[model samples]
Target: MKLVSFRASGADRLGIVFPENKVADAQQWGAANGMDVPDSMLGLIDKGLEFRDSMSAKVKATAVDDNADYVYDYEAVKILAPMPKPARNIWGIGLNYTEHVAESARSLDTDNKLPQECIIFSKPTNTVIATGEAIKHNGNQTQQMDWEGELAVILGKGGFRVKAEDAMDLVYGYSIINDISARDNRRQGQWIVSKGMDTYAPMGPVLITPDEIEDPHNLQIITKVNGVEKQNGNTKNMLFRIPEIIQDISSVMSVDPADIIATGTPAGVGAGRDPQEWMWPGDEVEIIIEGIGSLKNPIVDDTY
Candidate 1:
């Protein structure tokens, strides 16, 4: 099932996106069916898998019912990031794709050798913006802003030292993330300021449960700027897959519910281009991941 966090009636509510582009108010559906439901996406995730499974079953069984009162046209509501306010900064995996590593090496003037392990980075919670939102292009701060389209994993259960074999069990769902970066702002290899600027992370159109996806690694990731395709690659090219990523991070720190881990982008970013492409005002960026959905956003100049 496709789950979403949307704004309707001047309030944020949890929703389920059904066929025909309809979004059902999940809380209201639960209430009508004599089932208790959380008002927000994070609240529902915190309820654990048993509750989520039960709710998913119920939704699937009764979705065909004529529940016009709670269902709204998808376009009528404003969709927000699956986790609007993540409990912590979003975890980012760097150099996970071999081709991306090579391209990055050329752009950064570093050695092309691949990392022996997953390279982790963090994008602050403030960096997140939902689909259709504007990505702030601050000319003073960065003249070489670039995009990295990645698949983000949302953790359902918290744990330290999670084993790779059991890592999949901790996942709540998956979404798309555009890891916007300022190519020139890297200060001595540190990326927090360069990549964590406000509106830098564009996430979501919807969150797809694990049940809907058979193999995350087999999916295609395509990115486009304006109307032109920029990045076309598959998750199979990832040097470090999801399981190892979870185990690596969990070995050092606790992975908690609502914590997002972006699995890194593919090759073909603007910085890797011959002439070097950069996004400016009046441009739009769109990321499409197979089975998940499309996350599109406009680029706007920072007036303040």
Candidate 2:
């Protein structure tokens, strides 16, 4: 099921997106149909599987019923991040792809050596944004704005010292994130400052539940800028997959429900290119993941 957080009629509500672009408003439908449901994506995630399974069944049944009253126009509702307000910082793994590592090395004139383990980073919760939201172009602060399209994981259960083999059991679903970065900050080794700008992390048009995606590893991830394809890669290229990522992080910090893990990006980021193409006002950045969906955001100058 493709779960979503959306605002309709000025109120935020949880939605289940069915094929054909139809969305069922959980809060409204549950109220009208006498079925209780969570009003937010975070609420749903915390409610556990029984609740989600029941809600999914309700969403599916009510979607196909011509007499159902809660189906709304997908285009009319404004989409938000899977968890519009994250409970904590979004965890990220850096240099987890070989090609990306090589490109990054070449760009920074560093050794073209891949990390033996995942390089982790974090994005402030405030950085999160949704599809169609404008990526704040900090034209004044820094001119080297870049985009890193990555596959993000949402955890269902909180855990510490989790095992790699058991990682999938704790995962809730998956979404797309544009890990926008300021290359200048990165050049100075200020990762958080470079990648944590508010609205820089453009994510979600749809959040597909784990059941819908049979295999996350084989999915194709593509990023395009203003209609020109820039990054093209498959998740299979990831040097550190989901299992290892979960094990690596959970060993140090407790992973919580609604926590977002951005499994490193692939090659072809602007900073890694020959001419180092950067995003400017009026440019559109789009990240397309195989099973999930497209997250497209326009760049708007947020300069003083």
Candidate 3:
């Protein structure tokens, strides 16, 4: 199921993506049907299977219940990040892809040995940016900004010390994130300053449930800047897949419902380029993960 959070007429709305790119307005549909479905994505994440089943049934019923009038043209509203602001920092892993590790090492003129374990990082809540928003260039703070297209996993159920085998139970769904990084500020091995800037993570168009994805680790992920394909790789190639990542993260901290996990990127980031490239004003960046949908955002100076 493809679920979304949209903003229109000065209010936030919950929706389900239906056939032919149509969006069924969950909030309005519930009110009309005398049902009290969760109106927020966070509520849906915590509502669990019963809510999902109910919503799915209602969405199907709307097709024939001509009076429902909940389905809307997908373009009528502005898409917000499925989970606009995660409860906490978004968990991130670096060097999880061999090619990325190689490219990064080459760019930094360092050793190419693989990270011994899951190298995790955190993207504070402020980094979250919706698909249609602008990725701030922050030209005043840093002159160069780069992008990392990644598959983001959202947790529906909170868990701690979770086992690798059972981690799937904690999954809510998946979205795409552009782990936009500021190469200049990523100094002295500390990425917090470089990665924590506002609008660093451009996420979503919608979130797709596990049932919609046959194999979470086999999707084709691609990133294009201004219509030119840049990063292209398959999720199956990640060194530490979803299971391992969940297990590793949950062991250290309690991952709450609605938390996000940005599962690293494949190679071909701007920083890895021979001469390096930085996103500038008006550059459109599109991160497309097969099945989840594309998240496209434009680059703009911090001023506006």
Best by TM-score: 1
Off by over 4 Å in 3: 31-35, 57-69, 109-111
Give the least accurate 10-residue stretch of model 3, judged by summed lDDT: 60-69
| CA lDDT, candidate 1, residue 176 | 98
Better candidate number, 2 or 3, judged by TM-score: 2
Q: How close is candidate 1 to the true structure, as a TM-score?
A: 0.98
**Candidates ranked by TM-score:** 1, 2, 3
What would the TM-scores of all predictions be? 0.98, 0.95, 0.94
Better of 1 and 3 by TM-score: 1
Candidate 2 segments exceeding 4 Å error: 31-35, 57-62, 109-111
Winning model by lDDT: 1
The runs of at least 3 residues in candidate 1 whose Cα sits more than 4 Å from the true structure, single-residue gaps closed, are: 64-67
**RMSD of each candidate?**
1.1, 1.7, 2.0
Tens digits of per-residue lDDT for model 3 on 152-233? 9998888899999999888888999999888888778888988899999999988888778899999889999999999999
lDDT of 1 at 54: 84
How do all the candidates rank in terms of lDDT, highest first? 1, 2, 3
Candidate 2 TM-score over all chains jointly: 0.95
Model 2, position 236, has a per-residue lDDT of 92
